[model samples]
Target chain A: MATTEAARPIAVATTPHRRTRWRHVLTGSVVPRVILIVSCLVFLAPFYWMVVSALKTNTELAQFPPSLIPGAWAFNNFPDAINYIPFGLYTFNSLVITVGATIGAVLSNTLVAYGFSRIQWPGRNALFYLCVATIFLPYPVILVALFDIFGRLPSFGIQGAKSWVDTFLPLIVPAFFGNPFYIFLMRQFMLGIPKELSDAAKVDGASELQTFWRVILPLTRPAVIVVLILAAVAAWNEFLLPLLYLQSNDKYPLAVGLIFFTSEHDVSYNLLMAASTLIVLPVVIIFLVAQRFFIEGITVGGVKG
Target chain B: MTAAATSVKPRSVGRFRLGTLERRNLKWGLLFISPWAFGFIALGVFPILYTFFLSLTRYTGFRSPTLIGFNNYTTMWNDPDFWKAAYNTLYYTVLAVPIGVVVAMLLAIAMNQKVREVAIYRAIFYLPSILPVFAISFVFVVLLNPGYGLVNLLLTTAGLPSPNWLGDPAYTKLALVMIAQLGAGQWALVFLAGLRGIPIELYESAEIDGAGAFRRFRSITLPLMTPVILYDIIIGLSFGLQVFTSAYILTGGATRGGAGPDNSLLTYVFYLYQQAFQFGSMGYAAALSVVLFLASVILAMAVFRWARGWVFYGGEEA
Candidate 1:
C-alpha cells in the first residue's frame, strides 16, 4: 500500500484532490485493490504455472527461476501425460463412480433428512443421533471394519462375482444410504420452508411421497443442488476410498490418478503440474459457475454460528 | 342468495374430521421415509456394530477374523504415539480453531467496512477454500520451500532468517497449522453472513449509550455471535482432526508410513490410515477409529452443553 503511493506521486499531486483520494483509497487501503490483485496472483499462480509447465518441454522445466511463462507451450504434454497412464480409462472410471455416488447420496440423504425433519416417528431422535454420530468416525477406523464385511462376502448379493471391495460398488453405495453431513444440511434447509404448505397438501389428500416429490423437492432446489454439487465434488476428488477399494489403476479417480502419475515419473515438476491442472479444472469450472449457491448452501447448511 | 350459497359447502369425497386423516398421514409419512429407515439399518447401524465387533478381533483385510477382545484398545492406551497423535491434534485444535475463528471474524469485519469491490476481495479470499487440497498443498510446498521459495525470499530480503517449514520436525505440525489459516476465506464469508444477520438496532442502541467500539463489541456483538462460533469450532475440530491430504501428499503418501520428520505431523487419522490400509491391521484400525469417534462425540457434546449458557437464540432472553 505505502509502496504503491511511493511509486506514483507526481500524478497524485497534479490530479484533482478527489481523484487523488480515490486513487489512495483503491491503492493504499488495507485490502487495497493492489493487495487484492497480488492475492489473486498468488491464488491463481499455481494453476497458471501448471498450464505453462504442462506446455513446456522437460528441458525448460528444470531451468532456474522456472519459466514464468512458457516459450512454446508443448500442447503435446496433454496427450503425452494422458498416454503415460491409462488416462482415458481412468477419466471414464471417475465419471461413472462420481456420478453414481452422487445420485445415490442425494436420493438417500434427502429422504432420510426429510424423515428426520418433518416426519414424526418412533425412535426418531435416537436414530437421528446415531446418524450424526457417524460423522466422527474417521475413515481409518471404519476402513478395516468395512473391508472385513465387504471383502469376504459378496457385497449386496453380487456373489460369485469378483470381490466387491476391489470394484466401484463400495465407493458409490454409501451415498445412496445418505451421509450425515448432507442430512444435516437438508434438514436445515427444510426448516426454512413453511409447514403450512405441507399441511395444505395433506388436506388436499396428497400422500407424503407426492408432497415430497411435487412440493418439497421443488422448493428445496437450492439445498438439493448444493448437496449434489458437494457430493459430486467430494466423490470426484476422493482418494482414500478409491485407494483402499480400487486394485486396478484404471479404476482410479483423478485425485488418485494424479498421485499415481507423479509416483510413476521421476519428479518431473512440469508434468506433475500439468496433471494437477487437469485434476482441478473440472472442479474450478463447476465451482465458478455455481459459487453463489455453493456459498449459500454452506452458510445455511451450518449451525448459524 | 350470496349468504345461502356461501354457507353451503361439503365435498362428499373427503373426510373433514382431523383424527382419521391424521393417523393415515402419519403411517404414510413413515412409509415415505422408509428408504432412510432401511439405510439406517443397513449402512448406519450395521457398520457401527461391525466396527465394534472388529475392534475386539484381529482381522486384517486379507485374513479371517480372530477374537482378541479389548486388546487393540488396551494396546493403544500404552502406545506413546497414540498420545503424541492426540497431543498433536489437540495442539492443532487449540492453535487453529480459536485463531481461525478470530481471524475470520476480524476479516469479515474488515470486509464489511463499506469498501468498494467487497465482492472481489471476498472472492479472492475464497479462492483457496474452493481449490483442491492437493493444489493448496503443492503451492504451499513451493511457497514454503526453504531457499528459493517466495516466502523465504521475502523474509530474507526483510533481513529475517527463513525457517525450514515442511522439512523441520519442530515446524512440520506448526506449518500444517499455518496452512490451515490460508483457506480461512470460506469461514470469513460465513462469519460475514452471521454478522449481517445481526439486527442493526443492537449497534444503534449501543452507540446511543456512548459505548465505544470495543465495549459495543464486547457487550453485544460477541454474545450474539456465540452460536456461530460454537458451530464453527465443532466443524473445524472434526475437520482438523482428520487432517490427512496435506500430510499424506506432503509426506509422499502413506508408504512413508507416517507424517514426516519424526512423525511431528502424525495426526490420529494419519496413524489410523497407516494401520488399516498400509499395515493391513484392519482390526486395530477399527479400534482406533472407534476411539477417535468417541473422542469427537465427547467434544461435540461438550460444545453443545457449553453453548446452552452462552448462545442466545433470537427469542431467548439473556
Candidate 2:
C-alpha cells in the first residue's frame, strides 16, 4: 500500500449545475432570496442588539422606543468597562486558567487517546467505555465531594490547609488527567489514521513511541489544533466550575468577575453591557482568526459524536 | 533477496509468549495511559459508585451517610415536583431537540450552498453559538420584555395578543425551547460535515434511478447519515436534561428569587441548584442529582440499544 505518504493530490471537481428550469424557479427564485434575507436578519438581530446596547448610555438604552443604533456612539463605554470590574486581573486569571488547562489537557488527553487507539493493551476497551459512560455524570454531583477531596490534601502537605478555591487547583488539575470529550475526539482522529503507516514505521525499526512522536503526532496536527481551539473556547466560556471553586474577586475569570459588577445595588446596564461585550471580544477574535481551522477542527474532530 | 526475506516468517518465541519489545511497548502504553486509567478508577468510577450508595442514604455535607433503604426513591414517587420537573424536562426536550436538529440540518444544508459572501454568512449564523449565553440571555430579555420588547412589539403590531415569554408559565417553556434552538451554529456545522460525508455517487445513482429529491434524501441520505443522527440524538438529549444556566440566569440567579414565574422554567438541574446551594438541602439535592443521572443513563442506554437497529455503519450490518 502507498501508505506513509505525506500528501496526495486533492482532485477538485465542481458540483454539476443540474438546475432544471422549474427547480431553479422554485429554489433559486426571488421568494427564497427574500426569506433568506429575513432569516439572516433574525439570526443577526441579537448580536446587533448586544453591540448597540454596549455602545448606548443607560438613559438611551432604557428608552421606550428602542434605539436601533446608539444616538451618540459612546466610545467611552468600552474604556469605562475596563474600570467597571478589575478587568485586567480577571483577564489575567482567565488567561492563566484557560491556557494552563488547555495545554495540560491537550498534552495528557492526546497521550491517553493515542494509547487507547494505537495500542492493544489489556482492559483498554473497558477503560474507554468507562470514560464514555462518565460523560453523562453531572459535574454538580461530584463537586462537593471533589471539594472535600481537595480540602483534605493538606495531609499530603501540598496546599498547607489552604482551600483549593483560592488557588487554580480545581480548574487546572482535572484537565491534567485527560478530559473525556477531548479523549474521545483524539481517539476518533487516531482511529482514522491508517494502521499501515504505523506498521511501515515499525518495519523501519521505529519503536511505538517514536512512531507516535515522529509519525503520528506530526500528521495529526489538524486534530491537535482542533483540540486546542475547543479546549480554549470551553475554558473561556466555563462559568459554573469557576464560580463553584474560585472564591476571591481578584481571582475571578471574566465570566464570573462580570457578575460582581452587576449586583442589585448598581446594575449599570450600560457598564454591564459594555463589560459583556468586552468579555466576548477575545472569543470573537479567536473565532475569526481561526475561522477555517476552527470549523474544520470542530466539524471533523469534535462534532462527530 | 527482499522477496525471500518478506516470505520468511518473523522469529518469535511462541504464540503465547511476548517478545521483549512487545512487553516494553505494553508497559509503556500502560505508563502513558496511567493518568486516565487511574483517574477513571479513582475519581470517575469511585464517585459514581459512592454516589449510587449515597443516593440511598441521608447524608448532609459534613456527616456520614446513613442508609435509609429507598426512602429517597419512595419520596420521589410522591413528590409532585419530581414528576413536574420530569414532565417539564421531557416537554422541553421533545420540543427543543427535534426542532433543533431539523433547523440545524436545514441551516447547514442551506449554508452548504455555493455562494459568495458565504464565510460572512457562516460567521453571522455561528455568532450566537460562541457568544456568551449571558449576552444572549440579556439580549433576549430586552427583546422579549413583554411591553417594549421587539418580539412582542411586532406581535402587537400585527393585531395579535402578545403573551409574556419568560414571565408566564404557559409560554415560558415554549420561549426557552425557541431560544435554545437559536444557538444551532455548532450542530449545523456538524450536520454540514455529515452531509459532506455522503458519497455523491450514491445520490447520483438514486437520481438516475428516478428518485426525486425527497425520495433520494429519505432512502439514501437518511440511511447513510443514521450514525450522525443517532449521535446527535444522544448528545442533544443529555444536554437538554442539563438546562441550567439559561433558566437560572433568566430567573435572575438565586438572589433574584426562585425559578421563573410559577416555577414554569424550573428544570431538574436548576431545581437541584436551588435546593443544594440556595436552600441548603445538600442531601435532597444530591438525591435529585442521582435521579437525573439515572434518567440520563437510561435514556442513553436506550439510544444505544436503538442504534443497533437503525444506525447504519459504513460496511457493517446494523
Candidate 3:
C-alpha cells in the first residue's frame, strides 16, 4: 500500500501531460477520498453510538452483540434523565459560571490587549513576555496554593462571605483577571489595526480609553467574538476546578454534576448517555453557530506559538 | 508637550526623564493592564512561591502548617506509589504524544485533499475534539465494557482477543490513550493551518524538476512543518503529563482514592489530588506539585534545546 502510494507520484510526474489529468483523478483523488471517508466514519462512530445508546431501552442496552441501531427510541429517557438528577439546577449553575466567565474573559482580555498593543510605554514588551510565559505554567502547580488562598479568603476581611471555596467566585473571578491565551489572541488581532485610526480619534480630543472605546474596540469585534466563544466553551467544559471548588451538589455545573449522578446512582448506561447528549448538545450548537471563530482562534494560537 | 513627545521616538528618551505623552501613555497602559497584573501577582506568582513554601510544611486543611524542612520530598522520594504514578504518567506521555501527532498529521493531509466533501469531513473529525472530555470518557466506559460492549462484540466477530480494557492493569493506560486520540482533531486543525502555509509553487517547481510527490512532501513540506510540529509536541507533552480527568472518571472518582485496579491508572496529578483533597495531606501534595512543575520546565527546556538541530525556520538555511 505504502509503495504504491509513493510510486503513483512518480508515475503521474512522468506521464504525458494530457494523460496526467486522468491519472491524477484516478490515483490522486481515490486514495484521499477513501482515506477521508474511512476516517470520517471512525471519528463519527462514537457520536453515532452515543446517540443510539441514549435512545435504547434498558433491555436493549444490556443485550449482547449490541444492536447498531436502537431497537426502541425511548425519547422519554431524556426527560427521565433530567428527573433522575437535578438537571435543571445543574444547567442553571453551568449557565451562571459560563456567562460570568465569558463576560469577564472578553472584558479583561480586551483591556489588557489594548494596553499591550496600542500604547507605547516603557517596559511594555517585557511585561507582555512575562504574561506570555505564564501560559507554560501548569495548572496543577497553582492548584494547591490557589486552593489555600481561596480557602483563606474570608480571613482577609471580605464581609458576608464565609469562604470563597464553595462559591462560583473561584472559577469565574479569575477570568476577570485575563487569561494569557486570550490576551495573546486579542493583542495579536489588535496589533493589526492601522495606527492612524487610533491617532485620528486621539487628535479629535479623545482620551486613550475613549479612543479605545470608540475606534479600536469596534474594529476588534471579530477577535472579541472569538475570545467570547472560546471562553464560554472552556467554562462549560471545565471539570477539575469545579470538581475541586464547588462542594455542594446544588452548586455543581453539568460537568461535575454528571459525575455525581453516575457515582451515586446505579449504573444506567442509557440514562447516562442521554444525560451526556444533553450536556454536549449546547457545545455542539455553539460550535456550529460560530465555528469560524473557533478555527480562527485555534490557528492563530498555533501559528503564533 | 504631547506633540513634542509624539515627535521624538519613545525609545530614544532618557530613562528617568520621560516625555509628557510618554508618561501619560505609561500611566494608562498600567491602568489598562492592572487587572491582569493583579491577577498575575495574586494568582500566578504568589501561588507558585507559596506552593514551594507549603511543600516544606506539614499541614492539613483545618490546621496551621508546621515547618518540616525537606521531609516531604524525602518521603516522596521513597514512596512506591509516587514512583508508580510517575511511571504511569511517563508511560502515557511517551506513547500518546507521538501517536497523536502522527494521527493529526495524517488527518490534516487528508483534510487538505481536494475532495468536494472536505468541509463535512473536517467538521466531523473536529467535533469530537470539542465535546467535553468527561462525556467522551463516559461514552467509552460503555463502549469498552467487558460484557456485551460494542468493542468486545467487534473483537469477537473478528476472532480476536479483547482484554478487559478498564479492568486489567496492562490495558488501563492504553484505554486512556485511545480516548486521547478523540482530541487529535484539535491538533489536526493546527497542522492543517501549517500545511496551508506551505507554498504551492514549491510543489509545482519540484514536480517540474522531476521530483515525485513523495519527494516533494519529504523535502519541502516536512521541513516547513517542523516549527508547527515542535509547537504541537511541546503542548502535547504538557497535556499528556497532566492527564487526569479521564482517568479520574474512568476509575470511579467518587469512591475516594480509586486509582483503577492496582493503581495502574494513578496519574501524577491524580495522585497529587488524592493527597491534597481526598487524603487531606495538603503539604505532601504541594511537594508532588513542585516536582511536577520542575519536571515540566526541565523537559520543555530539553526539548527546545534538542529542537535546535531539527526545527527548520523558513528564513534560515536548512
Candidate 4:
C-alpha cells in the first residue's frame, strides 16, 4: 500500500555562512611550525622503533637504551620473519578474504543503497533505519550462536567443521550482505546523486535494475571506491574474528599469523617488527593512495551518525 | 510514461490505496534489498535473540541448550576473574576514551592550521590508525618492554622511572591506554572534518570581538563540536570497552590465555574468549556477552541522554 511518490529531492550541501573577517588564531609562525614538526616526529617514533628494532640483532635489542639505529641493518629479518611462519600462505589467505569481501561489499552496498535512494516503497525508510540501527549489534553477543551455526551446517556434521573453521568463509561470506556502516555511507553518497538521470532512463523504458546499473552505478564510482576502500581496509586489519575462526596456521591471516609468531618467538623483536612492517605496509600504501575517499567516507558517513 | 504507469494500477487489490508507480517502486525496492534484509535477520537479529537465550543456559557448541534461568548471570556475578576483567575494561574505557578524544581533537585543530604540505603531514599523523592493531600491538610490546623497549629508553633518558609495562599488572592497562593514541588517527580525521564543518564566520566574528584563540575555541568551536565529540565518545566507548587484540597480543595472551601479569590486562573480550574457548564455558561466555551488551547499551543511552543538553545541532537534526 502506497501513495503517489513525491519529486526526487536534491541533497543540498550546507550553505556557506557569511564571513566576518576575523584575525587568525593559529597564525603560521616559528613557534607553531616547530610544534608541528615535533608532533609529527613524535607520532613517527613508533614506526621508527619498529624499523630500527627490525634491523637490530637480538643482543642489540637486549641492550639498555637500545640503539637508536642498528649497528648493522639486518636485511635478513623480513626473510627470517616470513620463514618463521607460512608467511606467504598467510598473505595469500588475507588477500583472498579482503578482496572477496571488498567485492561482495561493493555489490551489496550499491544495490541496497540504490533501493533506499532511488526507489520508493512503503516500508523503505523504516527498513533503512532498522538496518542502520543494527550497526550497534555487537558481534560478540551474536558470535555465540553464529559459531554454533557454522559448526553444524545442516546435514553436514562435525566433518564440515574443517572447512568452516580455519577457513576464510567466516569473514568473506558476510560481506555478500552489506555491512551497516558501508551501506550508510553509500546511501548518503547515493542520496546526493541527481535523480533526473534515473528518471530519464525510466522515460526511456529502462527497468529499475538498468537504471541502477547503467545510470546510478556509473555515476557513483566515487561512492563505490569509498565503500571498497572501507571494506578492504577493515577486512584486511580485522583481528579477533580471524583469530576465533582460524584454528590452523595455514589458514591464518597476517593479523592472526603475526601474533602466532610473537607467542612462539616472544623475544625476537627483530623478526616481530619486520613482520609488523610487512603487515602494515600494504594498508599504509592503500590509505596513502586512497586518502581522499577514506577521509570523505568517514567524515560524511560518520558525522551524520 | 504516465499513461503506461497508470494502466498497471488495478492489478493488486489492497486495503490501502496505492498509485501504480508507487506500487512498482515498492516491488523493485523490496526485491533489490532482499539480500540485505535476509542478512539483517539471519546475521544480526536472529543471532542476537539466540545469544540472549543461549546466555540463559549452559551449552558448549552443542545443539541442545538446557534452560537454567538466572544461573549463568549469577555465576558471572560471583566470578572473580570476570570482575577483574570488568574492572580492567572500565579502567581502560575511562582512561582511554576521554584522553583519546581530546588528543584527537587537538591534533585535528592543529592540522586544520593553515600550513603548506598540510596534507602530507596529516597523512603521516593518520598512518598509525590505518595499520593493523595486531601489528601495532606487537611493535608496542617491544617498544614498551622495560629492558630493551624504546619507551622505557625514552622515559629513562627523560629522567623518569621506567615501570615494567607489560609485566606489571599495575602498568599494563596504562600502557595500553598510552598506545591507544596510535589508532587515534581516525578520530582525529573525524575531528578535522568537524573543524572544517564549522563555518569560518564563527571564528572570524569571535576574533572581531577581540576574543583570543582559546576563548574563541571555548565559546564557539567547542560548542559547535559537541556533536562530533558525542560521536567520538560513542565510537571510543565501544572500542575501549571491547579492546581485545592489543590486550591479547601484547600480553602474549594467545599463549597465556589472554591474561597478562596478575590478569591485569584481561579486557572484557579477552575474558569472554577465555570463558568460551579456554574454560569450555560457552554458556558463561554468552552470559558475559549479555552483560557487556547491556552495559554498553546502558552507557550509550546515558551518553545520548547527557549529550542532548550540550550537543549543538546548529540547525541540524538532533
Q: Compute fnat per model.
A: 0.30, 0.30, 0.67, 0.58
DockQ of all predictions against the true structure, Cα-based:
0.26, 0.30, 0.53, 0.33
lDDT (C-alpha) at residue B105 in model 1: 87
Which order, best to worst by lDDT? 3, 4, 2, 1
By lDDT, the best candidate is 3
lDDT tens digits by residue: candidate 2, A1-305 = 01101111121124344445335445533444554456678887877777888898877877766778799899899888898688898899889999988888889888998888887666778878878766665556555456545544543332342656457777887778887877887888888999888878777777677888998898888778878887888788887777766656677899888776556764666777788777788888988888876676657533421
* Model 4 CA deviation exceeding 4 Å by range: A1-28, A154-163, A302-305, B1-3, B6-15, B316-318
Flag the better candidate by DockQ, 1 or 3: 3
Candidate 4 backbone clash number: 0
List the candidates ranked by TM-score, beginning with the highest: 3, 4, 2, 1
Candidate 3 lDDT by residue in tens digits, A1-305? 22233555666668756576666666567888888788888788787888899999888998998999888789998999999899999999999999999999999999999999999999999999999877766788889999999998873433234799888889899999999989999999999999998887776767888888989999999999999988988899999999999887788999998875566546888988999999999999998988888788888885221
Superior by TM-score: candidate 1 or candidate 4: 4
Best-matching candidate per TM-score: 3
Docking quality class, candidate 3: medium
> DockQ-based ranking, best first?
3, 4, 2, 1
With candidate 3 superimposed using the best TM-score fit, by how many Å does residue B95's alpha carbon deviate from the native? 1.2
Model 1 stretches astray by more than 4 angstroms: A1-76, A117-140, A155-161, A303-305, B1-19, B254-258, B305-318
